[model samples]
Target chain A: MIENELRPKVNEFEIQGTNFSDYQSPLFIAWQLNSICNLECLHCCEEAGEIMPNELNREEVMDFCQQIVDLNIPYVAISGGEPMMHPDFFKICEFFRSNGISLKVETNGLFINKEVAARFGKLGFRSVQISVDGASQDTFEKMRIKGNFKKVIEACKFLVEAGVNTEIVFVPTKFNIHETGKLIDMSYDMGIYGFYTGKIMQIGRAGQNWDILCPSAQEYEEFFKVLTEKEKQYAGKMKVYYYPYDVIEELKYRLEKPSASLLVIPNGKTKLIGPLPFVCGDLRKSKLSEIWNDYQKAWKKDEVISFTKQVIENPELLKEANKWREL
Target chain B: MEFQKHVKVRQEKFGAVVFETLREKIFVTNESGAQILSLLQAGKEPEAVTNELSSMYDGDPAVIKKDVDEVISTLQESGIIKN
Candidate 1:
C-alpha cells in the first residue's frame, strides 16, 4: 500500500484490492533446508557459509517432512543460505509435493543447469525465484562475490523455456540500484512472470556493511519512484512488487489471532516470525497443534508487536531485527 | 487414532470434501465418505460411527455394520486413518 501512497490521484492503473484473504488452517511456511550456502555474497544475511554442527541430518529431515505435511501448510517457501545446496533438496521437494504442498524455492541459480532446469519444471513447484543483485557481471560480482551473472541469466532463460515459472528478486543495494531498471526490462523482455524488488535489510553480513551498502535517504526514495513508474509502464505485461511491503497490514486483526504462516528453522525449532527469536516449541518435541498454540501466544508478546511495528515503520530495521539485541 | 498427516477436510453446503492434504493428489471423496471422516475427526470410534449412521438413516444394523466395516478397513489401508 506504501507503493500506492506516493501519488494521491488514484490512477485507474492504481492497483486496487489485495491478494491476501482470510487465513485458513495452514497457509504458508518458510522452511529452511540448511544454512549452508555455496556463495559468500557480501550481502549474505544469515551469514550462512558452511553446515552447522547440529544441522538436521537426512533422517531427521525425512522424519519432519511427515510432520510438515501433518501441519497442512499448503504454501511452502523453501529457502536457505542456498536451498539448492542441500543434498536432499529434490527429496525434500518430492516429500512436500506427494503430501500436497505447493512450493516456492528461493535459490541463487548457480546450481540450475539446463538439465536440472527441465527436471525442476516437473517437480510441481509453484515458482522458483532467483536473486539477481545486479544486471551485469561486474556489479553482481562485487555485491554477491563469486556469482556468475551470465550463468544465472542463462539458467533463467532455460527454466522459462522448460515451462518452469521463473521470477527475479532484485535487492536494491548501492552496487545494484543503478541497474535495476535494466534488470526489470530484461525480466519483462525475457517473459519472466514476476519481478520483485525490495530494500536491503540490516541483517546477516549485510548488517556488517550496512553503513556503506545501504542506500541514502535520497537514493532510497529515488529507487522506489523509479520502481513505481516502471510498474505503471509494465503494468499488465510483467507483474511488479516494490516493497516496504504492507502485506500483513491488511490482516491487522488476523495477526492478533494466530498466524497460519509457520516458520520452521533448520534446527527444527518453531520460530515465531522471521526476526523474533522467541521459540514457540521444537517441532520434534511436540505435536504441531500444541506448538501451534505457542505460536499464537508468541504473537501477542510485547517484543513481537514492537518488532513488527519497527520494521513496518522502517523497513530498514529488517537488517538488524533478527539480531533481537538491537530491537 | 488420528487422521493421516496428509488427510484434510473441507466443508461445503451439501456435505464435506476430504482429500489427502499435500498436492491433494491422493484420495478424494464426497457425501458418505465425507460424513464418515467428519465423524472420525470429531473423535467417534469405528463401532460408534456404524451405530450412529444406522440410527440416523434407520438402516438395518447388520447391513450398515457390514458397509461401515468395509469403509473403515479401506480407510485404514489407505493410511487415511489409524488406530
Candidate 2:
C-alpha cells in the first residue's frame, strides 16, 4: 500500500493520537537505493541513468536501516533507479525483515527471477510493486525504453507463483492511456492481490517531452471513467487502484499536520514526495530520527512552503513541479 | 456489547485506535471513549458501564445515563458494538 494514501484527510480522520513518544517515528519511509537503472523509461522521474555515484555504500545503508528499525518505523518502500540493482538488495531485505519492519520493494520488475521471488517469499514482504508501464509488450517496451519485455512479465509471474504479494504498477503516460483496460484485464487474469496505476508526473525526461508524454486532464478523466467500470467488473476477482494526478489538492489538507511518510534519496537526502526538489536534510549529515523529528518543520521552510502554497493555488503545478524544470 | 471478531483494538495513553480489519475501517477516540470500549470489550453490560463511569467521573445520574446511552448508540451505529 502507498504510505501517502494512508495520510489522514484532516483532523476528523480515524488516524489520530496524543502523547506521542517521538514524532520522529514516521509511519513509513520510501528510500531510493541508487539511480543506476537498466531500463530508462521515457518519463523517468529520477532522470535515472546508467551511471550512478555518490550512493551510500552497503555499510552506511545497513547502519541507516538499523537506525530506522530502532526508530520503530512501521513500513519502508525500497525503490530506486531500480531497487533490485542495489548490490545489497537481499541483505537489506533480510535486515529489515529481521528487525520486524514490514518491507515493500518497488522496482522495474527486471530483477525478480525465480530465485529472487523465492527469497522474497521467504522474507515475507508486505508487498512488491513491479512496474509494468503498459498493458501490452509492445506498448510496455515503447514506454520503458529498453528491457526484454518478456522478462519483466516473467519476473512478475514468478513472484506471484512463488507466493510473493506481487503488485503490478502501470504508469499511464500519453502513449498507453488507451490501453489501461488491457492493463486491468491483464491483472484480473493473473489474479494477484491487485495492481496500481497512476498518472505520469512530468519531470526529467518527462518534463522535456511533457507535450507527448503527459496525458491531458480530459484524457485522464476519460481513462478513469474506463477504470471505474473495470473496477466494478473485477470488484471481487481483482483489485485495481489508480492515483489520479488531480488529487494533489488534498495536499493542502495534508499540510495541516505532519506528513505520514517521507522519502529518502540515494544520496541520503530527505526528499519530498512527487517532483518537488525540496530536501530537508541529508541522512548522512544527521540521524534518520533527527531528520524525521524535523520533517514537519521541514515543510514550513520558506521556499518549499511557498512552492506548496503555489501548488495549492495552481493544482496544475503537480503535473510538473520539479525544481530543475522551473530553472 | 461484544466487539465483532477482528475488531482489533490498541490502547494508547490518551485513547485508542480501533481497527475493524474486516471492514478496513479505523476509529479514533478520546480517553473516555477508550474507557467505554475497554468496558465493552470486557463484556460489561451497558447499565453496569454507565454506573461505573458515573461513579468514576462523579457525573449526574440522568446526564450520565443519557450520555452513556448516546455513546453506545453511536458505536452501535458504526458497527463497533455488536449484539
Candidate 3:
C-alpha cells in the first residue's frame, strides 16, 4: 500500500493511448466495490470480511459512475473483499463499459464459473487479474484460507476460454517465496496474458502478521533474481511485472506529484493509501472532482507529511491506520 | 455528423485514440486521422472535413475529398461517429 498499488500497467495503458499525466481528472480509480468477502485472506488489505453498513447502494454507485463519465476518466480497477460478490457487480461493469470507460478487475476468481466467465468476456474488460498466491494448493490455501486452489485454476482456464484478457497476481512473502517460479509456469500454461507480483505490504492483515508473513531482505533479493530470469524466459510469451515498494520514493512521489488516482473505499470515502489513515472527503457528500482536489491538497499538508513520517518510523501505527478514521 | 455521446476521442502525441463505449473498443489513428476525428467531434460534416483538409494541406481537392470520405467511412464503420 506504500506504493501506487493499483497503477495500471504502463504498457497496457500506452496500448490504449492513455497517458495518465495528460489527464485533467484522475484517470485511474482503485475502487473497493464492497467490504464483504467470501474468504478471510491472510493479507487482506482492507481487513475486509463483514459488510460495511454504509456501502454504496445501487443508485449511489450509478451516480458515481455518472460523475466518472462527466470527468471523462478513462480507467477504473475494481477490487473489494471480493468485487464479484457485490450484488451490482455486473451492473457496475456494464455501466462503465457502456459509458466508454475501460475497466480492469481484481478478484480472487472463486465466483467465476463458465457462465460468469462468458458474461465477463462479453463485458470486454480490458483485463481481469485473479489472485492465485501460491504455486501449490497447500501453499495457496495457507494464504487464502478456505479458498480452493483447484477452483481458482479452473476459473482462470474458463476466463481464458471466454476470451477475456486474464492475468495472475501474486504477493510474495516468507511462506510463498519458494513457489515463485512454479507459479509463473502455471500461469503461462493457463494462457494468462500477464503475471503481476509485488512484495507484501506492511499494512492491513499483513501488517498484523508482518513477522510471520513478511519476507526477509535476502528472500526478496533472491526472489527478484528468480523474477529477472523468469522475465527473460517469459519474454514475448507472457508479460511479467513486479513492483517492489520503496517507502522513501513513495513519500517523495506523494509529496511532489501524487498519482492521478484515488482510492474509493466501500463506504464512499476516499482514503489515503499506506500508513496514512487520512480521509480526504466523503464521496457520498462530495463530487469526485471536489474530492480529487482535496486529495491533491491533502498530500501537501504538514499533518499528512508528518504523520506519514511518523508511521514510517513507527510501523506499529499502521494497525491504527488500517481501520477507518474520520479525518 | 457528430461523434457518439458515448464515444470519446483523445488526441495523443502519436495520433488520437477513439473509444467506442458500446463495443468496448479503442481505435488509434495517425495525425491526419486525428484531425479528421477532431473535426467530426466538433460536428463537422464530411464535406466540411474535406474542405478543412483541403485548406490545411497541399493535396488536390479531389484527393482530399476522397481521403475525408474514406476516414469518415472508417469512423462510421467503427461506430465512433454517426449521422
Best by TM-score: 3
Local error of candidate 2 at A106, Å?
A: 0.7
Q: Rate the local accuracy (lDDT) of all candidates.
A: 0.70, 0.71, 0.79
**What lDDT does model 2 reach?**
0.71
Q: Which lDDT tens digits does candidate 1 get at residues A1-327?
A: 002221111111111121112222345668877888878888776777888657778888887777667655656788987999888999999888777676789999999999999988878567789988888899998988878999999989988988887889988888889887888999988888789877675667887787778887788788888899889989978878876643234224335544456777777777766544456767667776676666766677787777667666765666653443311
lDDT of each residue in A247-310, candidate 3, tens digit only: 4445545655566678898889998764568888898899998888787778778888887777
Residue A241 shift from truth in candidate 3, angstroms: 0.3
What lDDT tens digits, residue by residue, belong to model 2 across residues B2-80?
7664355556544655654333355666667677778878889989988887777655667666666766777777776
Complex DockQ per candidate? 0.03, 0.11, 0.08
TM-score order, best first, reads 3, 2, 1
Candidate 1 docks with a DockQ of: 0.03
lDDT tens digits by residue: candidate 1, B1-83: 48765455554333343444332233433456556667778989878977887777755777666666766776777666774
Model 3 lDDT on a 0 to 1 scale: 0.79
Cα lDDT of model 3 by residue, B1-83, tens digit? 86765465667665566665333466666667778778877878788888887787766788777667777777777666774
Query: Which predicted model would earn the best lDDT?
Result: 3
Better of 2 and 3 by DockQ: 2
Q: For residue B32, give model 3's deviation from the true position in Å.
A: 11
Which portions of model 1 show Cα errors greater than 4 Å? A1-24, A245-259, A302-327, B1-83
